[model samples]
Target: MKKTIVTVLYLASLIASAQPTGLPAAVHPAEQLAALDGGFWLAREQHQLRQLDGQGQEIGRLAIKSTQLDARGHIAAVVDYGSQQVQLLDARPGQLQRLATLPATHFSVEALCLYRDPQALLHAFLIGEEGQGEQWLLSASPARKVRNLSLPPGVVHCQVDDASRQLLLVEEDFGVWAYPADAERPFQRQAILLKQPYGKLKGGASQVVALPGGVAVLDQAGMALHLVRYVGQSWQYLRSVPQAQERDGIASLAQGILAQGVLAQGVLVRDAHTAQWQLSRWPTKAPTKPDTLPIVLPLAQTDPVAKLGDAADDPAIWINPSNRADSRVLGTNKKQGLLVYDLQGKEQQLLAVGRLNNVDIRQQVKLGTQTLDLAVATHRDDLALVVFNIDSDGVVSELGRIPTGQQDIYGVCLYQPKGGGLEAFVNDKDGRFLHYRLTMQDGKLQGQLLREFRTGSQPEGCVAHDAEGVLFFGEEDKGVWTTSARADAPSQARLILPVGRRLQADVEGMALYHGPRHTYLLVSSQGNDSYVVLDAQAPYRYRGAFRVGINLDRGIDAASETDGLDVTSANLGTGWQEGMLVVQDGHKRLPDGPQNFKYVPWSGIAEALKLD
Candidate 1:
């Protein structure tokens, strides 16, 4: 009889019918729960957000004053919290909808999350609250734009991990902070703190999860559970788990902790042979190991091309002052325009020349009677600057365009002024800046604007030293400024790297290097993918910060959000004969396709910062 109707349909699918008995009990006290995919979401405390099922049965409610979850928990945003609005929904299984709402802001949102980046894009951070009380972090994007981000005045709650694409936060009496939820850099009011390990610690952290190399939290009036981890760029303290009550949400399951308490909820399970002997006793202290940073291995990579999202961003080495292994790097492909590599990273040329964004190189220019070696670039389609000459067998030709009547052209640099000619600084998208200069009349090369400055907000990675007439730029939200490359001088500028120290707020791509006695600079600490270096002279001091990691015998993959970089003391022969840096990886992760450029080996950053 067909196995007796398959044993009565496998006992009615193990007695399915989750529990939905017409639900009603949470009009105001859940505080947070989550679960999803056919059941549970809660959030209560009277602001409402329900959505039950699987026998608890409300099935979708949402008056919401708060709720979050997206880092693939499948959507859910909510939040009205005094009308700083936002909706988002779509939590799956039978599919709920609402997808996008956002709009309200003059501050008042009170904590939110969502993140998606790795080129997936979806953003949305929102913590708001300022009417003079301060507390920011806004960030939107789904094209609604937004930005803000200042935070650190008592945060209260925020969480995003998506497996260490991190965003954490917490703060009532000051503790946890983290951030870098990969919105591709520029939100850094300095956070990575963590603190509050004991010193009269009693309550406050109410939930935080993240795990797999640490995070856990959960305190809520001392029903404890800690575990921090990160060490090496800070975060430490690893042990706590005492909890016999009060949890109000914790998660992290595959077979172990679920928490959720209004009086003790369950799921602790994890004994399968002593859970790796209880994580090998968990407790170690002499851990002060910090200066290590040296991975570098990408000997040859550059023919993959299929652009779309972040089509690589900036790189410019060009050495070959007559074959240093025939060197030549260029790179910019900001959605099609310049590429050229070789010194093994192959690809020799692309040049569609339309988008182009930030690129530089000067090397021996003279022009009218000929000497050439230019390169320029910053053409965001037509705000112009382009140029390019090279040749002598390394190729690259165009040699023209110079517009810059500025509309959005951004970040470029090429100086050459130690006493004779050539300039070009260019910046836009609102941090103003112009400079120009370059000459060669009857033979072509033009540019003349001379001077105009600004830098109040959105600047872009610039560079120039030309034997110290100085220039360095990058104000994208504030940090790294230095000025006066002589255009009548006096534009004054200053503020070295100051958006929460060691550069963060999009203060990207600067590069100087020089060295023989330390010239350094480097910057591009694009909000923590790391590079900072300094001491290019003066009080520029702070000399340390690396990150480019991961090699696996040349399989490579660990440079994140970096945007434009190029260094070279010029040796360029074997594994970068004491020189080469290149970068622009913005998440290239090995054979993982699209976006490229990453070739470190400045002697592995001079033996990982023992510098010289």
Candidate 2:
């Protein structure tokens, strides 16, 4: 490798005596600074911001209580403590334009930092002195959250490492802690160990600066610059370069890249230089391969649910036997009833049956002398199975409700045995599953408990392969399990996929895609906001996993926190010529409406994972 300034990192930390003799006019003092790569800096003092050049010359300034810039300094997130608002600025050189402003918090703010995700969405993370932490999506509306952090008091500094996708926090009296930066991920943090014998911080790090793939820690007590590199999920102490740590009391450490028109591509750390902060640079290896996220966007989305706030739960597709293009989607509005939509995602019918949770459909099923399709959902109010009949014209009407001989009934799926009739599998909150034999007696559909079994934990989502009569169910926090779906079959369940690696916990929903070329079992890996696909036959080869992303052209947001999903192999016109997959959009955004379902053609999934 070619020699760079990184070879002599120790010499780079030395404070040069040369000052900025020819400097820009006066200012209070650089209280906080974020230096950009191209000799630009975001210097904040109280509610005013001063843009500084490499020679410590002020170009422009703005008014903001607290602020931080992104990794490349292309954007800045500012907090107005007085107005309780957070703003985003287009921080590209001279154009510090105010892009958007929204309410941040109602309480007093403590610390703030800016982070950009792999999708190029800007986010602002705010921490309160009373241990309140919020991550706001700054690209559009500023405030939103998945995991709201309960931080410790006095944590005054935080930085988001875009390279490693980790959030670094500085607590002054305690060692630094690193956490997964994505808000969709669960809240988890690990204390980064950086005590290297003589270079250890007496109490904790005085200042920590995030580099491309590493972090530079300044120890005021021990007088050292500790550089730690992030290697595969954890941080490793590389080497601590000795330096005289000085507390100038004028400003905190500001870090940036020195590349454009400069002598080298190195980390630039500025210290107190008379009236302005001087610069010191050190080089390191460039960032590794770009992060290839596992995300899959939907082709179209249905209208937002009528009822707001987590009302939409699961979905089922009713394929029109006469005209496949007219097939309607049956989605459960947990707060209302069932919602039926056509292939174009418009609500066709709304059945005010009851508070329905999950839903499934068995097309062309025998009910008495009629060959009508049946849609069933678990009714929370009745503790029963609410059944619906879909006519050939794709119109859905209430059939009857069969009280499930259980409490708190959850998910339900339909199956037909090779030699026999239709069966429904419904589960309780405590892992109790009951299999019922459906019958159309006296023109009223009813269920008779045939057999039952219980898992170790709560299980909801389940789907049965009609060709094989094998049932697949998700044990939310555990994993997916399979068993025979026959009415007279024993409850001999077999563990298929355990929750780990690719399949995260709370596995919410499952669907089967019976394509001409491939039959795969798709499960909603709700824990990570992604879906897992496996073979339908024995061994169940793990095909791959993907996430439903936002549709920019259509202005539909990504789906997350999915409770239930359903798919069909019948061609549904235009984009869904190869069939379609419908998933519940748990956390709806991009206008922030009630929850809805997203539709993705099988071709998109096949192309994304490189499958047939």
Candidate 3:
């Protein structure tokens, strides 16, 4: 790679010409400025929050102690360390409306920044003297504490990179430490760049501007900019861009604008002593690898499973024939049992039938003369099929257990014939499957061995498409394969999609959503935390992929590391007119509880992916 240094040349003459460009007057000390949509928001040493236009003109002003703008610029968080209060404001051009005020940390704050979580909630990170750091959920009514963290001493500046999921803290005399932005994840930190004799930095790090997969740090003492590349799990100091002249006090930094001056891209700097600005210009460029686009926000998330780590594994949606609105979701607590949740994500029932891995449901099953809804799960403890009967009123009760001779049972799916025969296919960890015919003989449920199937590798998640008479299996660590579901069909399975760029490995879950013009297959690409969509029928043309983003409006975290998912093309009365897609949430946040399942409306996925 070519070693390129982004050199920012500062001219003192620009200082005298600053006022004409609408730059703030050089009277009060320069403070850190928050980047807004059309301009910037800042709290000067004069004890007031000021907004500046593109030309640096004063567009709005508020009497607040300190202000920090979220990356989206939709909300402004003002912190008054002295009074120990935090204020939230709607950050619009010329309309900085005060929304709410709440008491923040009792410790006197030194540095603070607003971070938006995967669930779209805004949190304020309060950094006090020494390494005292606390995270508070400001978006919650009355505000609540999230977690307490630690940082290297002397962090006068901090920023959250929502894109990279990293919280950057500049240790004035040392370097920059990138902490996991998701507070719920493990507490880990990486030294991104170091200062002085031990490293390449010319001066101590003062401020940082987050780039797509990197950051540009401002070395205050040396009057230079350090660009750092964020590699997987770590960051490296790439190079530096030195300034030509000194303009004093402390400087503020912001990004995301069309660069008109110094470095690379839109890195803007304002001198605290002069209130004058120095701009760094970076060539506007397109992103390299495509990002997880067209995000679909989750509507609701179920209560965390009883088991703590890696418990919630799969989910199956049960549509209510009598009342679609009251449809329930069936999820597996791999460490516990079966969990039944309503559309609102409230746990409606729990059946401690043993460790259940994967789950599936079939509505209107013929149980003698009564048509009932049934849920079938792979009981890992017994390596058998545990059944539950759901009633018209959405009530649930244990039916019976069907034992499979397989050594291990990891995934299960039901194949219900329209003519009234209910069968199930259970997969084991060694890639062996057993198909069983579920029957009622002498008024007792029994299982009769039908046929068998074999795969090349381990399989867990499986979905049966009744319309196509085909069963799709996720060969974990590989990709997907499908075979005929007919009782007498060949046991051979053909690989439809392999592990590749579009379909990431450890393919966790497979789901089928039958639409009016198109039937699609949704696969959980666990390696990348995204879902890949493909044609459900033959060729299985790849449509597109998307990530479940946090719904800031609802405070529901995105789903990740999914194990099993199920979709239904029925009118879910609760406005999921097209249908509903439910998946296991491997990583749960918004206070970091146990794993749960997230409810996503299929219509949102259809619209985002432009599905027919």
Give the Cα error of residue 465 in candidate 1, in Å: 6.3
| Residue-level lDDT tens digits of model 3 in 448-543 | 899887787898888888977898888987788888888888877888989987887789888888888888899998877789899988898989
Better of 1 and 2 by TM-score: 2
lDDT of 1 by residue, 1-612 (tens): 000000000001011111111123442244444554323343333466655544335656655565444324456565655655777776664455566676666666556666544433355677753311121212223334423456666565676655446677666454566766653343453343344464324645544555544555655453665666665456666456564444344432221111121111122212222221011112222212223334344455555545856888888877777678887888888788988988777787887877888889887777667887888988887998988888767788887998878888888888888776678888898779888887778877788897798877788888888888888887867788788688877998888768775566677888898978778888777766778788877798877777775444455455767878888887777777778777787755333457787788777777767777
Of candidate 1, the 10-residue stretch with the lowest lDDT total is: 1-10
TM, every model: 0.33, 0.73, 0.79
Q: Which digits, one per residue and each the tens of the lDDT, describe model 2 over residues 129-216?
A: 6678877665554344433568766565677767667777766565577877775444578766434343355556655666656676
Could you give me the TM-score of model 1 versus the true structure? 0.33
**Highest lDDT scorer:** 3
The runs of at least 3 residues in candidate 1 whose Cα sits more than 4 Å from the true structure, single-residue gaps closed, are 1-32, 35-233, 238-359, 362-368, 371-373, 376-415, 418-462, 465-508, 511-523, 527-560, 563-585, 588-592, 596-612
Can you rank all candidates by lDDT, best first?
A: 3, 2, 1
Give the residue spans of candidate 2 off by over 4 A.
Answer: 1-68, 71-112, 123-158, 163-293, 306-310, 488-490
lDDT of 1 at 359: 88
* Model 1 per-residue lDDT at 67: 44
Sorting all predicted structures by TM-score, with the top scorer first, yields 3, 2, 1
**How does candidate 2 fare on TM-score?**
0.73
